[model samples]
Target: MLIKTFENKRIGIDELTGQVISGVTFLNCDFSKVDLSETEFVDCIFYDSDRQLGCNFRSAKMKGASFKRCDLSVCAFNFVSALGLEISECKAQGADFSSASFMNVISHKSWFCSAYINKSNLAYTNFSKVNLERCELWDNRWTGANVTGASFSGSDLSGGEFNSFDWQSADFTGCDLTDSELGDLDIRTVNLEGVKVSRDQMSELASRLGINVLG
Candidate 1:
């Protein structure tokens, strides 16, 4: 399906059910308020040439798709599945990835500032050097994910799964960890200065640091 043929057109949810749309470059298309649930996009590229409006992926399922330099601000991606997804230098501010599942995906130099990523499964996903300031990431499962040089400053990481992880060169400055699960993590490795946490969390971290919190 050539997307240019559907230029200045609106593709709603009903028209995108389980359809295999490949090699279709969506340029200057508006996908706002569309429920593209369980849709398959292989080798497809989507971007807004205007750079003003963003294509909405509100509850859409994507596979083997790539996006370059697109704006995905404030879009909903609840319960979406994207395996081997590739995104580069895109603006995803305030986008909801709640309960979304991703695997073997590579996202480089993207801006996810203040994006909601709660209860999501991100196993073996590469998120190198992404800007994730003040993102809500509660109760998310992250296994075997590479976060080298990724910044999560001022983000909420409460009750999130953080097991068997490598956090080399990762920044967690001023993040909130209220009722969050942070076990098997060495406090001396990553940066956590001025990070907000409960009193119990402090005691646990202090013990790990070999400092007895007697109180």
Candidate 2:
């Protein structure tokens, strides 16, 4: 069956759970407050090149929603309840995720975040002040992405490309950073306590601090 296509329209569907939507085009559509739990969107286009805009997903309930090989560039995901959201091999550059919560709260002080955003392009995306602890965020491009005050503690960030990224602005303690490109990541300045890195990466980081590893 062919996938449905939507363009420049306001989507009124409230529930789209457990559906496989492939090769769909949602140009400048409004999906605010829509429940998309466990929905799989493959090879979809959410960005509009002519209008230079993307689909709006503000306040959307997106638990366990999977987006693979999709174009979600410049999309707005503000205030989204996105627990267990998985986005793989997607172009999500300049997307706004500021206020998006991937947490499942048990109490006021007890909460956990779950999301897998791997092998994607997240360059120039906004993730300021977001708490993404213990999430799977590996092998993504994060160049010029805004992560100020964001906590990525205990997350897997292996094989990521972080050119022009400010590591000091975010908390990456206890993160797995093996085989990732660590651009301008100063070990003397950034707190990497319990963060995993390869021996070659450690030597490279130490060399940046003017330390000679003769071994």
Q: What would the per-residue lDDT of candidate 2 be over residues 20-83, giving only the tens digit for each residue?
A: 8889899899999888888899999999989999999999889999999999999999999999
Q: At residue 19, give the lDDT of candidate 2.
A: 88
Report lDDT (CA) for all predictions: 0.58, 0.94
**Cα lDDT for residue 24, candidate 2:** 88
lDDT of 1 at 59: 45
Off by over 4 Å in 1: 1-112
Over 68-122, each residue of candidate 1 has an lDDT whose tens digit, in order, gives 3444443445545554344434445444555455533347744334345554455
Estimate candidate 2's alpha-carbon lDDT, on a 0 to 1 scale: 0.94
lDDT of 1 at 103: 37
TM-scores for the candidates: 0.49, 0.96
Candidate 1: give the clashing pairs.
Answer: 159-180
Clashing pairs in 2: none
